[model samples]
Target: MPSPTLTRVRQAYARIEAVDRPEVWIGLRPQAEAEQEARAIDARVAAGEHLPLAGKLFAAKGNIDVAGLPTTAACPAYAYTPWEDAPVVARLRTAGALALGTTNLDQFATGLVGTRSPHGAVRNALDPTRISGGSSSGSAVAVALGIVDFALGTDTAGSGRVPAAFNGIVGLKPTRGLVPTTGVVPACASLDCVTVFARTLPEAEQALAFMASPSGRELPALPQRAPGPWRIAVPPRAQLGELDEGWAEAYEAAVERLAAAGAEIRHLDLTPFTDAAAMLYEGAFVAERYTAVGSFIDKLIAEGDTGLDPTVAGIITRARDIPAHQLYADQDRLAALRTRALTQLGDADALLLPTAPGHPTLAEVAADPLGANARLGRFTNSTNLFDLAAVAVPAGLTPAGLPFGVMLIGPAFTDERLARLARLLQPRLRLAVVGAHLSGQPLNPQLLSLGAEWERTTATAPVYRLHALSTAPPKPGLVHVGEGGAAVETEVWRLSAEGLGQLLAALPRPMVLGQVELADGTHAPGFLCEPDALPGTTDITAYGGWRAYLNH
Candidate 1:
């Protein structure tokens, strides 16, 4: 094994062992087997081949098949060993993501409460006393605990989202059918979409790309420059239902942050969307759950097996008898609701909502599994119902010390937009350039070499002055002057954390990276000059920017 990859693998295993949360995984790949996979990846890396997910470790939800691990779906009675990996798993593995294990889940992917699993309730990584949100419970906890780089889960009705909210991570539930579902156990098959959980939006997006089918519809490309502030729709406070203590304020704070970052928030009537969400289980759509695993569970019950969670079994059993006529009638109602919901969402880039009503305790979930789980899905269940894409990001912690989150819901194929909006709501390492490092300038190549991408062209908040520093290649210094300052022209660039380190390492003495407040109320690391170097610098504030000064 290449030393780093092997070392990382060992550390991951060590973390998993240290956690001692057996419920987080239903089965783990033998340490030796994982080591062998890492060694093979090292050999490929040594051969100069690029692997996007190189040396990355990830866990697959048990409902999804991973070769050598029995596809248990958290129901031992229904367990079966699959000879091949599921399509999603295969794609991720091909991208060099080593599988560490198959995680636990609500039996047959049924509950939004992680406690339905016979393996045991998946505990929240942030607080063991809290419920981890389910049926993708273990998957989210695994990512949140940093036991793996990322994880794969399935979302039929908020399974992918709620867990992320409880655990405080990014959960990207792609547009339906974007990631192939072959070789995976069905939950509500048609609406069952695969999801990825990572500590950040970018990592989740990267893993999604590796797993997305080539033949699937391509995500819409983002504009080279932002046209204007994003139009984000939010439900009225009254329609948000009863929020937990501090959750309402946390959500408003998240919205305010987005607004400060230049998003135009529009009040929206959520009747259509919320009504459709009710239909997922409350309406005839529940029949689909029965269609997925009813027969298997029925056979198990007939054979006198009691492996499935009683609540899960009761749900599927009742769903089997939902009249076909009711299914058709509800389907028609959903069609109309989808249209109305989309209309209400028209022209808006995305709909922002809390990922869950609140973080529930294990006792709360156990006390009222149905009520608690239903409340958790209040905002998320409608996503797939509307055929929309969503990105759940951590908003902040509630005053009560529990993590809170919000999700951006966008139209189908708008995955990129949703992710971009999600990033805006989170912290980012963006750099502002006023001079040679601006696009097409002499020193711009340094940024490109560090894998930076241009974010947008804007100006510093009218509180900065530009100066032509006496440096080779003629870099400009952006001085933060509180009074009589001009809105200096600049471009923002987004780069990786490692790229930032490299930039700091090679930074010239006179130029230092410091926080620059932008016109849009956001701040970024920007090029500034030391006071000593400003003595002989030419005052160029009147010229607006370095290029303009040079052109004159």
Candidate 2:
């Protein structure tokens, strides 16, 4: 009598063994261990416990420690067995997620290409010959190939997002320090962030929320979701980097789609962001990586057991010569650049960009590792450097049938907002609720059960009236009155089309879903009262909102 979730977990393990992709995992937990965890979760479920992530399968990048697993950071010589899981991993486990294994990464978590590992390069999930972007390489591929529901990856300079872009998954890189790095091997300690990769934005956001620090300090107020039309910033056409024909076409199509879906696309100068990205590797921040593992690398070199990836070794080794003064200078420069970048993001909801310039074949990376890797991080490196939250989602496939992705970037703590925006790029609808259904209201649970996420609270465009409808539970109705009406307060929520249908079917009499215009002049599906049925309703437009009417 195994639950369906347990059945899926078993099926996932079987698929993992059947696939037999050795390069995807550096170390795997025994199937017995996973089963035991799943059984425990089922027991908890039977006891009536609510688990947000009940029975979800997940994997962690090798650098993020798991209890009883060797944390190699993709370098066996530097591997260490940790007695406890990384804080982020522990959080997921507590929420009922089962870890399958530790996935491969670029050696020392230094390279963006997947090949910088002793375990072997992680091939693209879709086409093995192409590169799987790294240093979170295998974590992305695991989720991409359906081996896991979601996986943990760390982002320093694009490791989390780049791999997701290449593999056609949703990658969420939370603001720096939002997820603790206690048990993770550092690349650039100050810039590193624990990121999540999943098939959908909501799933990724759920994992991120569970992993975030419980203390409010690391978790900022979740961004209030803003209903469309979203003000999306983009780089000028001339500023866009050169891309292969297939990627260029796909990226352009994505932009066109966003515009068609009611987004106000604004082109801006991207030099400041790009300039900040260059500083991650070219500036003194590189010293942070050296500080984390330089000694171990030196020891390996001295013993002539230099089992490290040559490219990663070279990158870390060069940091030794960075004088203290140079590091200070770069820090100052970075601070100024951060200010400029934040200023540029002033009023825009989010910046939209190609996740990577193009997808490169494994042969391309082998021929020119540095160049190929650099190109892959073009839109990603600056995200951490500037302390921004980012979500990379699959846009569609290239003409060559390879995946193409786009990233939505926003200021720190905008993880929730970015997820909301990302959903617009998918199959969902924006719903406006005027009464009872607002957050914290008695009827709010119904919307939550329908997978509805509150976008924002706004008002009608000074052309609507509020009326307290005569009903047993007592709900308010939003009525349109053209030019003489006062704006009525409303909360906008998002839901899948199926959820909308269910909501419409369940709506009580006199209440129907219709177009309601917001103050911004954008129309969303909202509750409206049938004019003939308003005879018994009380005019409460003077109070402005349902909550206000109730309080008065």
Please give, for residues 1-552, the per-residue lDDT of candidate 1 as tens digits: 345567668979999889999999998999998998888888888898887787789999999999889998999977889899998899888887899999999998888889999899999998999999999999999988878889999999898889998898889999998999888899888899999998877678899998899887566674354466799999999999998998999999999989999889999899998898888989889888888889988998898897878999998999988888998999899999999998898788999999988888999988998888888888988999888999888887898777788999998888888998887787445888899999989999999997789989998899887888777887888788889998988899998544665676468777888999999998888888787777777889999888899999
TM-score, per-candidate, Cα-based: 0.78, 0.76
**Lowest summed-lDDT stretch of 10 residues in model 1?**
217-226
The true-versus-predicted C-alpha distance at residue 360 of model 2, in Å, is: 0.7
Q: Largest lDDT belongs to which candidate?
A: 1
Predicted candidate 1: what Cα RMSD to the true structure?
Answer: 10.2
